[model samples]
Target chain A: MTKVTFIEHNGTVRNVEVDDGLSLMEAAVNNLVPGIDGDCGGACACATCHVHIDAAWLDKLPPMEAMENSMLEFAGGRNESSRLGCQIKLSPALDGIVVRTPLGQH
Target chain B: MSRCPSASTLEAAPIVSETVIIVGAGQAAGQAVASLRQEGFDGRIVLVGAEPVLPYQRPPLSKAFLAGTLPLERLFLKPPAFYEQARVDTLLGVAVTELDATRRQVRLDDGRELAFDHLLLATGGRARRLDCPGADHPRLHYLRTVADVDGIRAALRPGARLVLIGGGYVGLEIAAVAAKLGLAVTVLEAAPTVLARVTCPAVARFFESVHRQAGVTIRCATTVTGIEGDASLARVVTGDGERIDADLVIAGIGLLPNVKLAQAAGLVCDNGIVVDEECRTSAPGIFSAGDCTQHPNAIYDSRLRLESVHNAIEQGKTAAAAMCGKARPYRQVPWFWSDQYDLKLQTAGLNRGYDQVVMRGSTDSRSFAAFYLRDGRLLAVDAVNRPVEFMVAKALIANRTVIAPERLADELIVAKDLAG
Candidate 1:
């Protein structure tokens, strides 16, 4: 199991274990995570499952696309470290990464 | 302008990070969480939400969910174990009261603190309530949550008097369900037609007959005076001195964005949270998504806030990418859908500024696609029960391709060439 720590927008920390190969947005939906909605069933249509990547690992993340950026125009409170959690796939290499949510989600 | 690449090809090898926070528990939030994982970000994920239940879709809340046709489990995008398998920490029923951008922390109502490098706000919208007398009566209903559906469902007893105050999709949808359930549904609209605001006159006429045929009493140019129910239940009186025997009242005029937090945080807010093409707020480090943001569209060349599942989810994805420091601007053609009785209404792009509207299907058959053209430019389309036309219209809208008005009128235009 891959152990992942979640720091909520309110600074609440929850550590959970998960199998590899799942999406980070999937992890949140499976765990009944609050802020990640994933409305479009992983299609890039809805941005309910938004999260912010910790700046420490900013260089390690993949770049966003035009579609993702275009959709962000509709997302509120975006910052430099903001990344749609659904865009990120879960893997062993992603262990110990942290993301902060906004005050609330879709 | 170069067409945008698919999100799949943009996935880069994610660097290991220590914390990822997602606020709110709506569809956009849920999608972002999954996208981050799917895109290979094995970061620590935490989702903070104020709602007690797990994240669920709200589209059905005013329709199937209220009708009891679909179970609550079906409302979930995934099964219960999906989150557990994904290792996402879900903090439900907690509200984040404050944000310290300087310190990179959030303050919870319970006096707890959560530190983050970045944050996302998917806090969606709420039903706009009326301020008339007896507006808070127990018989009043506003559909926005599962609980709201439950109350409306319970009140929809057979022969129960139903008074719908708005003629919008939510109100019309609820009326269809209620009328089918054997309740007398009366929709009171201040506008001249049921869907006068969003659709063209001809398109509006098609649905006006639909609801009228469904045993629904659609009162146009009507306004509600007040609810005169006892503390628990009663009837609705209109501004015209007409009284409808209403056991319950449902308001579906429109939605008001939950922009308090964003506004308090000093983000630029108009009718909704205003974001640029990159989904960035006037204030850097803050992003807004979903029905809450008003952004400009290249197609319309006007700022608009789309209230549809399509806008919400796509915007959420864009915000995520922007937060990740991989900026891509949001520019998808807007699309929306509404189900009323057996008619499926699908639309792509905006018809607000259009001057010409051509019909592609037979309106006599209660099905057609209304194509909106602005200065001969194919601007948008509202297709009813015409999925093929809708698909083609999406392509046309995306490519900004123009069609001969005569072919559209004659239904001779082929759709295959418009799509990939």
Candidate 2:
């Protein structure tokens, strides 16, 4: 299990143990963590599951693909650290990864 | 602006102990409940659904779930504790039989009455069935509910013959899964081409070729006349005097909005329940959203009834905000997607009135985007396995950008650069 933390728009931090091989979006959704809608169910189609990876852990995670980058362009409040939670898979190597969700994704 | 649910306001109203009752438990209804709580509406929220289970995602019903790649429990949008934690009272296994508009109350099938200060009609829609002889046979089926897919799953045996009535997305998606599962699948479409009503002929032909290459037989302009069989086996008769024996038959014609209850309550319904930009129905203190709503799309500049999860979720949020006294227009750019085999077809914007079609990338390579242009203005785009192009096209369509046809047709130019 990997320990992940999700910070909401209002600075509400939620820490949960996510299983390996599960995406960050699924971890948030299964644990009832608000702000990550995952409307398309991790298909990488809808960008509702937008997130901002903490700067410290950015290099530790895999690079963003072209599809995810394009989808994030439509996401509100997108920045250089912006990444789609659905495209980020959980693993033991990324145990203490921290991410922040945007205020809205439309 | 008249504070009485007018169409011109973008502000939230003051909240009280008002009870907001949402009818229909689907993606839209689920979003409505979530948005209400997210917006800090402490009022009571009662969700009434006909299905026994909580709200689940429907897109997987014909794809992953059918292929046995996804479990039934995973399809649920949220766990059971979600409603309890969110303070949402759910009425499952019972449907609202009657709606008394004046009283702001709905009568349940079990003779229970629930009154509310505001009501949300998200009744969704039902699958259109085959209106032919033997259509009621025990071997025939229509996919809409979990039970329907379960029944079809049991019949999808290896080497078993499966006949799909329509060649729409649902039918094609199911055919892809059925073929992958070792079933001999055949699709019969009444239109001249599969997906004729939704996509351009070029895109339709592309899909047809993809399905044919997968060993699925597709016959266009051929209507299923009748289904002749009992409990054991069946034969699907066609208009051209040909018959194909099958172990199971599924109808994927289309969906019809569940507007009988809304109509009975004297609500204005055209193709669907008519609502304004704020998702307000003709009646005050009442609103409608999701597949059951026909609202004006500002981007399209016309009223359209979209049966997509994006539309449902977006409209549900708009209705919930309006109920909380925050009236914002529902002007979301309509988008939809479908996954068949290894191809992911992503469509952005509505291509209703297109005058020219520009092909970007290589169609032979099966990775391209079809740009619909109306007098040099981007209208819509159908991107197959090309997500970047589809995403850029959405921005172009939303901005109503006009581009030279040569730039769009040039595969050498990057999607972002072309849009820029």
Candidate 3:
């Protein structure tokens, strides 16, 4: 299992150990993390699972697909580090990945 | 702005001795449990569900679950440990046989009685079954629960003849999955076109064409008269006297809201359990959410009973707040989506009572949005692979924004800029 740190907007930090092959959204949701909604069940349909990865870990993740990019265009508070949690799968290379949830989700 | 009480305020408040009994453990029931805890309701939470397993998402049951791409565990909204950690008392595979509103208690099928200070009726709907002859045939199926989808998946073999009784989202989604699995799929719709109840004819035509391109046969204006055949084969007889042979049949006609318990309890019900904006039922201390409640929509100036996941989740949260004395009104534009083949159809707001439709972009490109307007005001939008338009249109509809048809149809005008 890889360790993932979810930093909420209020600065509340939660460290969770997620199994490989599960997406970051699943890790947060399964662990009862508050911010990430994952309303569409990780279909990349809903943008409620928006998150921002640390700049240092940006290149470690997979490139954003066309659908994820288009959907993120309307996500609230999106930026350069913004990515859909459902689109990024966990792997051993990204052992201690950190993602910050936005102040609010769409 | 109405804000929830801070964590410190909730902690400082009196210890809650009240118990909240939530009936019908589905999407709304699951969310209610989470919301109650998140809102710092340190009370007893009992979730009663007829289904044996924990609450799972039903949308994937028709798409990814049927396609064999998403596993069963992934369909669950939350893990088992989360429920335990949340301290939720769950009664799975048990039905609420009686609801005594005056006494503020419910009788379970297992002869157990539970009293509650607050009652949440999240009892959702069931798939509407066919009333014609042989409707209960062993070969016929309806996709509503995990068991239903599992049955269909087990029968989904390559080259199998599959007949769909309705051309709605569920049936069409199954048709897409079955066709992709190399099955001979046929869709029969009773209306003049597919998705007639939900979308306009133009959008329906686009979806129908896409399904046709995928080699799925769609027959509209056709009604099934009966079902016949034995173990080896199943035949569907239509009103046109055509007997369509099928290895199995799936029906996605519609859903009938489960309101028997609410009705028996003497709560007002009109098509669905009648509720106010706060999701409170006719009875005091009793609230209802999800597909079973007919609540008012301030935006539309009408009552609506929505079956979308968005409504279920939002209403569940709203109901929880009301139970906690937060009492915020529930009002939001409804939205729904469908996945067929490689296309994604996202809809925002209701297109009902629309006076005109403005088409943005060319449908031939397979990426366009249809804007529904009434008296030059935005009412709703049906976007096919147009995520930006869908998102902007949702906001525009909520704000009752009025945009000219020419400006809406112009391809040069960016979707976001239309808000100006």
Candidate 4:
């Protein structure tokens, strides 16, 4: 299991232990962490699960694809660190990764 | 004017904590269960589903799942451990035999009785089938559940002949996948144009062309008179006297809202279970949501029964909020989407009572948007391969902003700027 920390817009931080094969969004959702809607069920079709990855763990994650980037553009408050939580797969290398959910996802 | 009481007003009323029972284990029920917990409702959540499996996403069943690009396990909305961890008691593969609204209890098919203080009817719709003779042949299929798609996928082999009985989104999506998998797909539509009921003729023509280019035959204005032959092979007889041989036949006519259970309980049901702005049926303490509900929308000002994942989620969230004494009405604008081949069709708002359609981009490029307007107010938009415009159009429609037809057609003006 990988330990991931999720910070909500209101500064509510939740530390969750997620299986390696699960996505970061899945981890947050499974732990009942609020603010990450995951409306499309991780299909990359909806941008409701947008999150800003911590700079330290940004390089540890895989690069965002064109589809995911396009979907994130629809989300409010997008930035260079902006990523769809569903697109990021959890792994041992990113065990201590931290991410923050944006204020508005729709 | 708000139709339901405000959250603060509802909180001021008397509070009674009791178990919440949600019927039908589909997308709406799944959302209701999660939303109840999110809304801080610590009561027991008993989710009763007629199907044996847990709640799963249905959209991919026709697209990625049918094309073999998505795995079966991924179709699940959440991990199996979610219910156990959330303290949601799931009773699957058991149908609710009767709803004793007076007694606040529900009888299961297996002779089990469950009582609840609040009941949520999220019983979604079923796929409409062909009523003609030989429609029940073994080879004929309908895509609604996991077992249904599994059967269809097994029959969809290379060079197989597939006759889709409808030209709606479901049928067309399957056609796109079947054609890519090297199957000879033929779509039979009773109307003169595909997607005529949902979209304008110009947009329907574009999809018809896309399907034809992908080697799928679309026969519009052709009615299927009957079906013949045995379990091995079938033939579709059209009103035009054309007999088309089919290795497999899948019916995607439309959906019939699963309101039988609700109606039997004396709930007010029109096209579906009649729900108000707060997703409450005529019967108090019982709420409804998802495709099985016909509710009033503040945006359209018309009664509608939407069958989109967006509506299901929003309505489910609204129902949960109301049950928790938050009482937020279901006021979100409706939106829909369809994935056919490489094109992604996204729509916002209803195009009903439209007076004009303005094209924003080149149709030949297959990356354009059509904005529908009634009088001067923006009503709806259909965006294909243009996510930016679709996003902006959603905001514009929500605000009811009116843009000149010329400006909408012009490519120089940024879509986001139009909102300003």
Residue A73 of model 1 has an lDDT of 44
* Candidate 1 lDDT, B315-393, residue by residue in tens: 8777777665556688888887777887778777888888899987788886788999987778888887666667567
List of chain B TM-scores, one per candidate: 0.93, 0.96, 0.97, 0.96
Off by over 4 Å in 2: A17-22, A30-35, A59-66, A73-80, A91-93, B1-16
lDDT of 2 by residue, A57-82 (tens): 99988898877888787677889899
Give the per-residue lDDT of model 3 (tens digit) for B1-420.
122344445667932788999999889998899989887788899999999989889999999888989888888888888889989999999999999999999999999999998999999999999999988789999999999987888789999999999999898999999999999999999999999998889999998999899999999999999999887788999999999999989999999999999999999999999999989999988999999999999998999988889899889999998887776788898988889888888999999999999999978999999999999999999999888888888889999888899999998988877776
Compare candidates 2 and 4 on TM-score and give the better one. 4
Put down candidate 4 lDDT per residue, B24-115, tens digits, no spaces.
98899988989988777777889999989898889988899888887766777777888998888999998998998778899999999999
Could you tell me how far off, in angstroms, the CA of residue B119 lies in candidate 4 after the best superposition?
A: 0.3
Candidate 2 global TM-score: 0.94
* Model 2 interface root-mean-square deviation: 2.4
Q: What is each candidate's DockQ, to 2 decimals?
A: 0.14, 0.53, 0.69, 0.54
Candidates by lDDT, descending order: 3, 2, 4, 1
Residue B157, model 4, lDDT: 94
lDDT of 3 by residue, A14-99 (tens): 99998888999999888878888888788777788999999989999889988899888888888999999999999998889999
Clashes of 3: 0
Which candidate's DockQ is highest? 3
Q: Write the per-residue lDDT of candidate 2 for residues B1-420, one digit (tens) a residue.
A: 243344233234435477999999998998898888876677799999999889888999999998888887778777687899888999988899999998889999999999988899999999997888888889999988887888888898899999999999999999999989999999999999999888899999999999999999999999888989778998999999898999999999999999999999999999999999989999888899899999998887899999999999889989998886676788777899999988889999988889999998867898999999998999999999888788788888888899899999887788767767
